[model samples]
Target: MNIRADIFSRLSRTDAHLFYLPPCPTPPFHSPPPQKRSPLHSRDKSKEKNVLITGTSLNGIGFESARVIAKHANLVIMTGHNSDRLNLAADTIKRELPSANIRPLILDLSSLDAVRKAAGEVNAFPEPLHVLIHNAAAPIGPFKLTVDNLESQVATDHICPFLFTKLVAPKILSARTEHYTPRVIFVSSIGHGIGTGVNFDTLGRPDPTRYVPMEAYYQAKSANVLTAIELSKRSKGQINAYSLHPGGIYTNIMNPASAPKEAVEGLHKLGLLEADGTPRKDATLKTMGQGAATTLVAAFDPRLDDKSGAYLNDCVAANELIGPPSSDPANAERLWNLTEQIIGETFTF
Candidate 1:
């Protein structure tokens, strides 16, 4: 079926769909937020708000989210791992908007402990978090493991945001204008299909010899989408969570800056490109400003109210069943459980 038809089918059966779609071999195509709803709530519809963009130091989706949010919102907190890059990004934003309220913080999401701690600090920030954009992620690198021995992909992508959102939920909710609701947006990828289906039992297992880095990365991304849906169901009526595929881009996401030429060529064979290679929606190479467009729209767009569990691509919803079946059924709960166990006492619900 076509992309739109597939999404319609999935939407038709949302009550029965429980898990995210898993990995696949070929036939590339497509697939398919919100906060509280008040009676005729226009108070939350204003574009001006406080926003947080994660994983932007490397200048991909988060960086783009920052730029786009700046166009309508006044304050943005950019979080990443590298201090120099964080400062440069902040400076670049300042140079462009001059009046932008951009704060750069170096927070590595690789460690579950660190994510919990950082969430506490951010939740306490004076400014309300109207939009929390979770964008930072790393492919579970071959041969790398966290102190807790979990895969880096799950640690950064699933557990980290899980805890971060848990910690900041109330703060985001408080930002809701009388009629508006707070939102949490995740920059997911089409690559997430590689996770097979979420493995309920071995979510964080780490062993490079037994892993395909990209597929593992895809698993973590799927966890992201599932978790978002689960959160929407659990939040009762507070914060909303969403996962979106930001389309294809040729950013440093693959560590292309360090990869050998052959590796780059291999991806090119698969149709993924970088910088000059990205398809331009309007005459430019999908600027960081533009790459973040959907994120900003999802964050502040009034249309998304009560759609707290939506999975998106290019700003529209997607239906995963048209693509494939998820690898596991207990994945969402299992991943959420493992994440809570990792955060332990440090994590806040």
Candidate 2:
């Protein structure tokens, strides 16, 4: 299953740009000012639109998303906990697109203080931030506490990102114009379907007596969806907030060495990897490019203007069977309140 070849085969049949461009032109809901131009324009105002993506390692979705979005976005900020990998990913993108304006920022999602400092640096950037992609996450073996005294998974996947988003909300809002709406994209997972809902009593700390590694991961993913929903509602359409399940790709998140055997086998059976268990480098499995497709769409798709809070899978709106739990208003609000309490700061939109 040569997935990359298949994608290229499909792309060979049409204008390759079709893969990245929006399906159709979607006019802004509001009329633009006389001199205001759409950010989608290739020249002038388009340079004002900047996008930030976290967790950008060499073969992950964040790196791929940055590569694709950099084709049009004026500036793409690629962030990660590792400085070397972050710079390397940015350099790789630059090699492919010499005109690309990609910058590297250090962001360790497990630490609230680090998130705050990163947000401060982002705020200081000369260009306004038009899009933020929270693409970094990990599934560890045990429930370890972070420096913030919270479960590592939830802290990285939800809490730190929640705080980062809140701190950067003003910058996101300030980037808005009649021609553009700032967007926040959460790179959630289909594992969210396994989650019941957030447990308010044991948010930062799971009950030690009844801890499950996968369950914790699912809960954090669900929290991602709920946070996006609550942020969208709180923003009153002023900002677009979305979460997505990037199609199963054989990335480090699912490395065979660290992941469960069954999980790895399932990925192999799904044609995302080879029999030897390495990610299928060919086009058969969903390539990193394919995994990043939905994130790119959710970030720039104009048709989503009225669909802020929507959960997307496979580059489109996910059905109720896989997406309903994350849509519960009560759960969203509950998580938002609990998050505010955990962070010791209330976010007012």
Best by lDDT: 2
lDDT of 2 by residue, 102-159 (tens): 8899999888889899999998887888999999986545657888888878889999
Q: After superposition, how far is residue 194 of candidate 2 from its true place, in Å?
A: 1.6
Per-residue error at 30 for model 1, in Å? 15
Off by over 4 Å in 1: 1-46, 259-269, 273-290, 320-330, 345-349
Estimate TM-scores for all models: 0.76, 0.83
lDDT of 1 by residue, 296-346 (tens): 556765556767777766555664521242223355555666767766743
- lDDT scores of the candidates, listed in order: 0.62, 0.75
- Residue 224 lDDT in candidate 1: 77
